[model samples]
Every structure is written in structure tokens, then in C-alpha cells.
Target: MQSNGPLYLLHQGQVVKFGFRVERRHVNPMDNLHGGMMASFCDMLLPLSVYRKDSAVGPRFLPTISLQIDYLAPAPLGCWVEGEAELLRATRSLVFAQGLVRADGVLCARVSGVFKIGPEFTPETAKP
Candidate 1:
């Protein structure tokens, strides 16, 4: 994830917004944002919609069960890409989320994911 660094997040009610600038490492040979990078960004960002500090589940690890991404347009180098994710539904054991990725307000990708709720997570448990 460090390779994709300098990620920023903003919480707005139930929606989570994320932003990142496209650097050289984030682009493909054609100087456009790489698809894999976009997918990884979505994977990391969408789960925030299911996170709640006051919920019975508390803070838990979310493991992706399925991720679907539709690429709509290209994001050129140096563009600032922004994304917004929201929880569509969540059960005790699963969470569903959808998100959109845009570059300078132009739609770039549409994403949806299903995540399995895992055991309680903390910084200690996150250590390798």
C-alpha cells in the first residue's frame, strides 16, 4: 500500500470520500492511471462505509468476498482522483458497498464489493 501512498480520507455522514494524486508509479505505460491501482484503491476505501465505532461489532477486519469494477474512462497522469463509497447493506456477517471513482469530476470507474465481517481488529492484531 505504501506504493500508493499519500491517500486522504474524509467522512461525511455515511459516505466516505478518498483522494489521491496520480504519480509516476500509479500510471501505466500510456501515462494513464493503472487499472490495478484503481482496484486496490477501491478495495481499501469501500470498507470504511461499514465501519462504526458504536456498533455491536465494533471495529473489525473486513475481508473482501467479491469485488466488481467497471472501468468507464481514463485518468491521465497528475490528475487528482477522488472516490466516494457508501454502504448499501450490512448484516451481522457481511457488508455490501458501492463506490464511484472520478478524476477531476469525470467518471472513471464504478465499483461494488461484498465483504465478510471478521474478528475484532486493532493495531496490535494488524501487526505481521
Candidate 2:
């Protein structure tokens, strides 16, 4: 379960920074972070971002309903990729957020996603 990353938070509060260390496995044949891994990283990052802001209720799963990514540049292997997400809007049942991933201060990708939220996401309802 920890395989996707040793993803760690740079700050412990609502506005958070997540950093991922680029490894050989995360690269494409061209030696850049793979597109799929970037997408997966965004998928994982957004929810964690949402959770950070909502941690007062304990963590809840924000199941992504839609996700879009714009690859601006290739993140070379051995670089530390970092990104931050903010909750843009939230309704009774859905939440929206956007984020950017960068390497060496260069934008690597931009991502935005919508997630479903409700009682189904409550901590007690979460599957172990």
C-alpha cells in the first residue's frame, strides 16, 4: 500500500505540501517520470489534500469522480517532485480541487479533480 510513494507532508496543516522522490520505477522509457505515475500521483495527492483539510472529522476517502492532468514538462529521475492542492469548492456531496506538481522549481504537471463525498466516506465506513 505504501508502494506508490513514501509521500510525505512538508507541513502538517490545512494547506499542505506533498513531496515525492523520483525513483527509476517512476520513470518512462525516456527517463522522465511516467505519465501514468503522474496521473496516479495526482489521483492520490488530491484526496490526501482534501483529507488534510477535513482531518478534524478523522480521514475520509474522497473517491475521485473525474481527474484531468496537463503535462507541462518532464520531471527527470532523481528529482524531488512536490505539489500542493487546495479545496476549490465543496457541496453536500462533491468536492473540487486543483494542484500543480513541480521539479526543481519547474512546473511538471497541473491537475484538477472532482470527488464524491458523503456518509459513504465516513471513517467508520472506510474499509480496512
Candidate 3:
């Protein structure tokens, strides 16, 4: 969701700002939360957070080389887990991005990802 990302975007430079709400389905067993979801969230948003790009389909059409995640604390269910991304550095093809997810105003997870920027994607329209 573009709206999810870019919660507070500063169009002043090459970096884009974003955010997303972590729903209960994003939680894991043990009744706390799942690490995979946090990792996935990081993987999905980190690129946008840094590169200043806005297309969510970037993942589907573009490519992600890898995602590194670090779990810091427990993320509770039915709570709003917020995330933020910032671009640190980049090369011609390789770009680095890092982000964090917080629940109930507490730090829950940290993540970094490398991505290859490519052509943007647009969803195909369906005929009714």
C-alpha cells in the first residue's frame, strides 16, 4: 500500500519515507509475533524507505537480492506495529536500505535489505 509507505515523505532528496500497520495475521505463534513477518515487512519496505521510490510492485517486478533481519523484542498481536525506512548508500545497481518495526511504541525488530532497481510495474486492469 503506497499509503502505508510514505507516511511522512520528504521530497527534498533521493530517499522516500514510509510506514505500515502490522495486523494480527502478521503475528506468529507463542502468541507474541512471528519473526518471518517482520523480516518480510523489512524486506518489502526497506527498499522504498531508502531509494525514495514509491511503487510497491517494485518487489514483484524488480528484484531483491537478500534481506537481513534482527529481532529485538516481542511484537504483540492486535497492536499497531509501525515501520520506517531510510536510504543510507547506493551504487549503480546495488542499493542498501535499513528499517525498524515498533509495536506499542516499543522497538520490536530491525532490518536491512539489498535491492536491484529495475522497471516499475503497474497492475493489469480486469474487465468486468
Q: Of the candidates shown, which would achieve the greatest TM-score relative to the real structure?
A: 1
Q: Encode model 1's per-residue lDDT on 10-109: one tens digit a residue.
A: 7756556788999999999999999999999989877755574225444888889999999999999999999887778778798888889999899999
User: Compared with the true structure, what per-residue lDDT tens digits does model 3 show for residues 1-128?
Assistant: 44223243345454443444555556666767677766666776676565445433243333688788888998776666677777656666667777877877898888887778665444563222
When 1 and 2 are scored with TM-score, the better candidate is 1
| Cand. 2 TM to true fold | 0.87
Score each candidate by Cα lDDT: 0.84, 0.83, 0.63
> In model 2, how large is the Cα lDDT of residue 41?
89
Winner on lDDT (1 vs 2): 1
- Which portions of model 1 show Cα errors greater than 4 Å? 52-58
Q: Could you give candidate 2's per-residue lDDT for residues 38-116 as a string of tens digits?
A: 9988998787887787653226667889999999999999999999888888877788989999987899999999998
Q: Rank the candidates by lDDT, best first.
A: 1, 2, 3
The predictions' CA RMSDs to the true structure, in order, are 2.1, 2.4, 5.3
